[model samples]
Target chain A: MSNASTRNRGIPNPLAWIGAAALGLFGEIGRLAVFSARVKAAAFSPRWYIGQIWKQIVQIGFFSLPVVGMSAIFIGAALALNIYQGSGRFGAEQFVPNIVVLGITRELGATITALMLAGRVSAGISAEIGAMRVTEQIDALESLSASPYRYLYAPRFLAALIALPLLVLVADIIGVMGGWAVSVFGLGFDSTVYLRNTLDFVTRNDILTGLIKAVVFGAVIALMGCYQGDRSKAGATGVGRAATLSMVGAAVLVLASNYIMSTIFVEVGL
Target chain B: MTTPILSLQNVEKRFGKNHVLRGVTLDVAPGESLVVIGGSGSGKSVMLKNALGLMTPDSGKILFNGEDVTQAKGKTRARMRERVGMLFQSGALFDSLTVWENVAFRLVNSGVVSRAKAKDRAIETLSKVRLGSDVADLYPAEISGGMQKRVSLARSIISKPDLIFFDEPTTGLDPITADAINDLIIEQVRGLGAATVTITHDMASARKIADEVAMLFEGEIIWRGKASDVDNSGNPYVDQFVHGRAEGPIQPAL
Candidate 1:
């Protein structure tokens, strides 16, 4: 009997599958690390592509404002309502303003905004770069000695890095105002009291921590997008898969990193 | 007598169990256009990539201007690359940029010329390809496929590179447009005085642009001769390919 007929081999060997998965994960991680290192190395390299960087900065920073702001406002209002309802059960309704501000400043404002941007900006980056990859534009750049890292990754990475923090800042303000508006009118709480409580409860460190996370999230978003994109296979479906992977991967990293950063902040007495 | 513009010696490349380029050795002289004809998956693209220093051969050497560049890295590789240009199979124009911007890419990126002058030069090059000035402002997505190919051709020559590689110059064009591209390629090669390597299965294109034609089969250059001699080559594989016969050693995929 032939080996193909004799052996069923329907089930994959569990150990082999595990090993392959582990190797594949490590390979992906290694590739990403190498890509990041190159992005850093090209940081101060010549032919800075100042115009491209500026264009990206405007695309990433100014263009992303409204969506991030709108998301923040809605989340803020919802969080205010939730806290008001939950705290009311414990007769601690007065603490709603404080918790809302703290939540917005330290966590939700940054993480939610980053996640939203991951879907919007990161997906956009990946799709655009993936299209370029499938079209062989990246290889074209390499053959021209134009340095894809300097021309493509550097500009977009720097823009996202500079943009996300500004977006987060806008998010934080809009969020606090959202809570304030809900408390002042809808929830029938005093406007001045809510504002005073928000100011008193949130610290500079809280805002700074969120901003720092913004930077990390920004890097993750752009880096994953470019990495997935640069490695995309040729075709529409391949580029589409790359875009999906980039958005999903960047969002997961943002959440994971947010947790880690928050833990470090707590441990460090923030 | 002068050093060949590009040389590949015993170059090998593999993708896992599939060995693509198997000790391929070839050379192209300056002011020559060497068209590499091969069946699909014959590793012609990989061989081009290896010669261009876009991919490292697992072993052997690639020399440009008498300098071994197979292992060239950092500034060395960059310097070698600075003198080389390629037109990708898909034209590969940056979709975000307009036609003029695509043509002026090398000049603008190198900062050798101001953007204003680069655009001027871009229009001038576009005109060389018979592209109208109106096409210059349209994005690559806005242009027809053939126009995109012309724009890609223009971009490749914008830097006046010493060596140029065209990966399937006429793969997806109508016969008329393909012939026009072939003509344009011949003109450009002569006008620029650049060593050229074009990979294609398009026999008409091969015959038109090839000063010398090389046939890549089974990851090796099986036969090479003047373009005019391809039809009379006695090698079975060459005869089969040149004649596009169904009954030969080369099996057409069903």
Candidate 2:
């Protein structure tokens, strides 16, 4: 007797994720369109819109502090060690403190950290809202004379806009401290010279520029994640695609925006 | 007899060539219970959805209180919705919200009452459905199926709307529980004197709740008469559907 119990298993493709990403971007765009249409259809009160601003503060600001702070600290310490080693080869090990502050503030610490948080938090926002939309809860609200946008997106969008920049600011501080710790303890730099060098190298423009990036990154993360999630169709599968797409799309947009902003800053002699 | 509060004229709906409602027309009088009966995919649910504006009819005039509301939107649609309550087949109580919260959702959303007042109203509705206040705090998933149905009923009537829709109200329950639900629906509708449209395949439920019964087959109302005439409805489709006979005008899928 021959038993036929064959399992046809094939290796999964890594590029399959790109399809998922595309689906999410499409959903996000669709949601944005719907939102615009709905807003145009029903113009609610300005006070309601303002209340949404405060709701965003609660959703984005107070919620994301711990995660951004922790990431910044770790990134700062790693950067300090890497910079010290690189400078040591050039017999300019003392420049490690200046380089760490400049490098972290300009590129890695602020923009990268903000982008990462956008992937995690903003994606979550989209998935949650998207699920609600598919499930007819949004329709239920409309039936009961509730504005879905005012009730749903207003707070979420506001939260991301308000909270993400604060989170990036915290990340910036923690990253500088991380660099400080690595330079003083890991490398043989005197604590006083390291602190003085960090202070001297820092300009108002560097801080301002990073803050600007944080704000824009926050908006991009929110818009993509929310748009994707809210516009998601096909129930559970749609939601999954929206979440993955939100992260990837937001991340790419952050990098691209960073280049654009930096260029603008340079051109304007900031 | 009161004037008809809701009327659908030549209503039709299709989803990608699948004709769900084919020139369906019905009139619902104020304070009357109209039970729409049919087999699965007989367009009973679709008809109700169209009536509620959840799914718009392809071509028809839906009149609300003598006003043509076929293309209404925003506040107009919402205002019409306010005077309506719906009990979905799946209960559809917001999973994240507590029983009371789900019941009071409309009240909160409309800003018609304060949160405390809404909770009080929720409690009152729950009691009307014979559910205790203890169940108010529990989530929909935490309760028994029968209890969830009762909670859904409570949510449906919490606002005491002028019109209500029940989509298979007593489905997925034992006979005893089903009868009890049927009784509750009848009693609630009678007490409120509200117009109601109940869509169900369950003959027993239809018999218990309907003042008038309309049997839908092949995307249209095949037979409509007083509830008492359902047992002897002359239409073969109605007879086959009510009796659940496999051999009938409604062909079984392979």
Candidate 3:
């Protein structure tokens, strides 16, 4: 019965299915590249929506502080405790402060903040824009001579690009402080010595690496959200799917890009 | 006759193999209200989108002011869009914005007027539609659907373009509210003196506001005539549709 159905439908071979999937993937990537280029053009265009950009910054950055802060503090405390335990087994408990600061500044701060934002901000943007698309508000904007790329996308893109590094900086400082508190109070370390070691071990290069990663992750989050939302189908289900896809896509892209950037940074001796 | 403000000559559009539009030709003269009536999936929305430059036709010329703008882009498209407005089926008001902001969106965004002045103008426009200023600060969700439709009308006509497209302006409303909206649409379109194209299957609305009526069936304009002549158009499809008869030549899409 399966063979009869396949014969009637003229189904392709497994190799053809693989080829079609590859083609679909490449087509999607090309479309994304084109979308990114259009967004870049719109960003640099003469018309700038400064007010919208400020609004988005306040929404994406200022509103996200509490959650990001809480996550950073907990992660930092956990890392400090784990490092103390592992280093004590090798009689290297004195190195706990250095490693904690190093880890937070170079990796955890930016990655954790981006992943959190990928869940929160990305989904929110997707839902908002997707709702607009389905309800024909985006079409209304177009009819009013407003470009969605300029009005809807560029503002969010600029906001995320400008805001994420600042967020990462705050997360880094808070994380380091959490580590200091844990080491001095919970682990019986000298406060002054831990502070000195943390300050000594963290360099400008370490902070710069995380900030750079934050910038890329920010762009990825906004791009994924806007792209998914703009192409969303018409209806409540469509908008819901777009939001889900935006969150999943942003999270996956953030992690993949983080790995690639880390490799590049290592290769460049950053 | 004067040059048509908008014209579509043999425009066609397709989605893969669906072939939604099949060589549709239409024209809307300045200050004229042309209502295109059709059943669901009859390509009325697609044809309207093509005329509004929201969608491109696969093959044919779309002329605005006698200039072919079938594939216009960037500044040309923007300039064309500035001269046209659309009231979507769902009212499509910006949920984040208040009623006044939604009405004055075009003015403030285009830098044509200051926010204060735009708000004043928005309230004035609202009064034209019989809406009080008390609703200005309220969001679209706070207002009734009929009021939301009024706000959408106000927004579309705020710029006073040369043309307007009303896509099913009275789709989801009670008869009394729908009639009220129809009255407002007639008043507003006449006030703007803009050429208008409205697509709807609502015969009551078509009879109330249409100067000329066109019936679309199977992606083609099957019959067109003056509004009074729509009842006796003699085309089977139009007769079937206008009478809402399910047993005519127009079979249900199963």
TM-score per candidate: 0.97, 0.85, 0.97
What order do you get sorting by TM-score, best first?
A: 3, 1, 2
Question: Which residue pairs come into collision in candidate 3?
Answer: none
lDDT by residue (B1-254, candidate 2, tens digit) is 56578898989889998998888888999998999988788888788878887778889888877777778776788878888888888676677689999889888767769989999999999999999999989998899999888988888888888899999999999999999999999899889989999999888899989999998877888788999998898888888888888998888645
Q: lDDT: which is higher, 2 or 3?
A: 3
lDDT by residue for model 3 (B30-133), tens: 99999999989999999998998899899999999998899998888988988898999999999989999999998999897999999999999999889999
Q: Evaluate model 3: give its TM-score.
A: 0.97
Residues forming the 10-long window of minimal summed lDDT in candidate 3 chain A:
A8-17
Sort the candidates on lDDT, descending order: 3, 1, 2
Tens-place lDDT per residue, model 1, B1-254, is 98998999988899999989888999999988899998999999999888877789999889999999998987898888888888889998988889999999878877779999999999999999999899999999898999999999999898788999999999899999999998998898799999999999999888888889999988999999998899998899999998899999998967
Candidate with better DockQ, 2 vs 3: 3
Cα RMSDs, all models: 1.6, 6.0, 1.6
Best by DockQ: 3
Q: List, in order, the clash count of every candidate structure.
A: 0, 3, 0
- DockQ, in order, for the candidates? 0.82, 0.40, 0.90
What is the two-chain DockQ of model 2?
0.40
Query: Candidate 2's C-alpha lDDT?
Result: 0.80
lDDT of 3 by residue, A235-262 (tens): 8899999999999999999999999999
A183-218 in candidate 2: lDDT tens per residue? 788777789988999999989888888888887787
List the pairs of residues colliding in candidate 2: A28-A227, A28-A228, A56-A159
